[model samples]
Target: MGAPGTARRGPVGEAEYPPLSRRSGWSEGSFSEMKYYEQGTSAERWERARTFFDAKRYSMAADILGGLVEEVPDQVGPRLLLARAYYHSAQLKRAEDQLRVLVERDPAEHYARLMLGRTLQRQGRDAEAEPHLRLASALAGDFAAL
Candidate 1:
């Protein structure tokens, strides 16, 4: 009982995030978390995530991107999309964790650092966010001087 061809059956099998009920409006039924991850290769899933994101279905994108990030942890794009999904969906801690990883892996990843700073600020950790924000502005090099 899933939306069209979305859910299938398979993965690490614990609920990584909440169910897909929030994204389901098709009257076809809800998606199984496993089906979401198991139905596609990494590239397919990445495309699905992007489509979901562009549609503003952040949770759905997050769901697909989350598994893709785990399967290809070295791929910055999926992880960045996952972080954006988390941030947009207000899953602040998860977003921070992902952005922090990106920042650490490539200290010059200014966009990630900017997101990390913003996530921290959202969590009311402005003091901790300042350094990263400053660094982001510096790396970006065209912002109004902080």
Candidate 2:
């Protein structure tokens, strides 16, 4: 028998493993086959980006999200997330550019319209923003009182 604190080795000379570290929750070789972006790519990237942003790692999050958006340009969610990252980082111009693309691609996307309206309003383009806000409100059934 092995010592109480030591693991017994098998015939192949592999020892029993200890518990995983609490800090990273990952073991060596365990994550070797995992891709950061696959299957739930956008959502996983978004979560990581948000974590970075929340931790005040704006530049890191922005860099990661920028790559994600570039790799998945057709995905509106990632684009919107990238725009939000830019907006949070005070890169309003880039945010506006991303949102503009979103509007062009999906005219009826209410959230995109609302965000675009907000961005326009921030830029003092009230006239341009009004229609977008109106469109968003209309689509969301919030325009009845407007």
Candidate 3:
């Protein structure tokens, strides 16, 4: 066992455990085998995901956003983007789940509520979606929607 402040080294001197202060990207194997979206700093990965999303590569964007969402679970931006990516990719169930989480966290989140309602509607659950859509409209001050 190594000292409390030190990581145990592998036979060739590689760190067995990354230091808590470092933000190492997650990987299953060697660096070369890591996915492109998983190979950069969080900011870089975020930009990459955004670029993919803008290009209409929703599945690829979701692939990157999924990891980002896990890494920054408390960040509403990444979670929202992930949900959008899922929605664009026609992954209604996933989009609904993420949107539900956001709405649960902030009941006044108009965009999330709107997305959740749309997702449910896409899944042929119009009756279940009406309340959320109404609430979202109310939150957005669209009284006509009510």
Candidate 4:
């Protein structure tokens, strides 16, 4: 017979079998707790940041957006808006860096690719700009004609 409370293993080792419910730390209440935790705080931060950006206070906007990005680094909207603020403030190199990260994270974002290409063109780096423009054109398809 096997050891106490131990079941015989199949093709795999004993550890390979699914654990009993008590063995896992999770309980049914964990999801509910997470949902409740995220209810209103994030929305409030986003609204405040958007208002700052709309006021044309680019430095303040950058600060707020930078904090937001740090809190939620994977959020595309904050990154895009931060890049826009940098561009409007004549921080072309910072804008380019932000858009480069965005494009690398999401290659399918044609708008980001196009904007990056245009920024590079403005910086007089046509060689570096060409590939992004081409990618954007391909993604935009026939609509690129407009």
lDDT of 1: 0.84
What does candidate 4's lDDT look like per residue over 1-146, in tens digits? Answer: 24433454657554544322435533344445533222245667577767777988776677667767778889899999888888777788989999999999999899889889988998899999988998898898945544
Write the residue-wise lDDT of candidate 3 on 1-146 in tens digits: 45444566777776487532224533333456757676688899999999999999999999999989999998999999999999999998999999999998999999999999999999999999999999999999999989
Best by lDDT: 3
Candidate 2's residue-wise lDDT over 73-109, tens digit each? 8988778877777877778788899999999998999
User: Would you list the rank order by lDDT, best first?
Assistant: 3, 1, 2, 4
Poorly placed runs, candidate 4 (over 4 Å): 1-41, 142-146
Error of 3 at 119 (Å): 0.2
lDDT of 1 by residue, 8-111 (tens): 44456553333344444322343333564435667788888899999999999998888788889998999999999999999999999999899989999999
Deviation in Å, model 1, residue 26 alpha carbon: 26
Q: What is the lDDT for 105 in model 1?
A: 98
Highest TM-score model number: 3
- The lDDT per prediction is 0.84, 0.77, 0.87, 0.76
Candidate 3 residue-wise lDDT at 11: 79
For lDDT, candidate 1 versus 2, the one ahead is: 1
Candidate 1 TM-score, C-alpha based:
0.74
lDDT of 4 at 30: 43
